[model samples]
Target: MAWDTEATKQKLLNAAIDEFAERGFAGARIQEIAKKSGCNRERIYFYFDNKIGLFEAALVQQLVTALDDVPVRGTGPEAVADFAGRYFDFSTTRTALARLTVWEGLERGYPVGAEQRALRSTGKVAEIQNALPSATMREAEDLLLTIVTLCNAWVSTPNIHLVLTGAPDLQRRRASIVRTSELLAQDTV
Candidate 1:
């Protein structure tokens, strides 16, 4: 049977998500993604140029989904709260994507074209920056770093099985993250 266009694209995207999650951009294999997606290797090349393209596509898709789910366009303390909650939700639900993002950060710092989105995201930082009437540039940087560290810690701590088990630890960890984020945000203000 032939796959429909949407189904085929979704399969490719899902396979890419899994493959890139398991391996970073450099290590992911097109063959593995093809096999997982129930398609041929050439099909992957047809859909996406190569492993790098697939990984980048996966990242962009994930980022788009993330933005849709928890748009942080608001620039306020509530925005920070929403950011903490939504980030935890997205990361926990999509552990593979979370891990892949972490790996990417560790390996390459940030994607080259991230400035487009990053500039928009900087509004949140600017909100916090504005709230800190006496804050210096270093203080703003520190505030951003603290939030990132706290969010990553909470988001990445839970595994898939832990999710399945309805583990109390996930809640506990998330609550800790939210509290820490709120506290840190308060300090910034």
Candidate 2:
């Protein structure tokens, strides 16, 4: 029987994501990941080179999937609202990915793959810019940043949100974010 290297690699990646999201990079254990994936510890090194490599790959993959799942389309407030709602849905539902992001910032100080990450961000910025035709590139980027931050904060800091709002309601928070994004988009036009 032939081993499916890709399938094995995916299982490892999935395990690593859970481990890293829970413990952060510094705290995550390779042996635990191995045990969780039912793979040998040695294979992690073979595929990812090191713990850092696995962390970066896991994070990058999550971001790629999120972006693909919630792409920006069309022009103006309605489109921006659409993107914001979808992005919020992705971010909130996939809390692990957002947790991984927070973990990376705290442990790494600066993000890994600064240039590559910037390129991916550039794509999102462009999408926002295209939707808000009257806005400059910088404005679009800032707006995108604002929408992301607003959406992520509620989920990432549920306790704080509950304290401030008296409830942690996904539907309400999502509606607020979408309304804000729509207004921002309308202001540009």
Model 2: per-residue lDDT, tens digit, 41-133? Answer: 999999999999999888888777776678799888899999999989888778777888888889999787566667888899898888887
171 in model 1: Cα distance from truth in Å? 2.0
Model 1 deviation from native, Cα RMSD in Å:
5.2
Off by over 4 Å in 1: 1-6, 72-79, 106-148, 155-168
lDDT digits (tens) for residues 65-124 of candidate 1? 655565544554555555676677777777765666776786667772376446644654
Which 10-residue window of candidate 2 scores lowest in summed lDDT? Answer: 110-119
List TM-score per model, in order: 0.69, 0.94
Candidate 2: where are CA atoms >4 Å away?
none
| Candidate 2 CA-lDDT value | 0.87
**What TM-score would you give candidate 2 relative to the actual structure?**
0.94
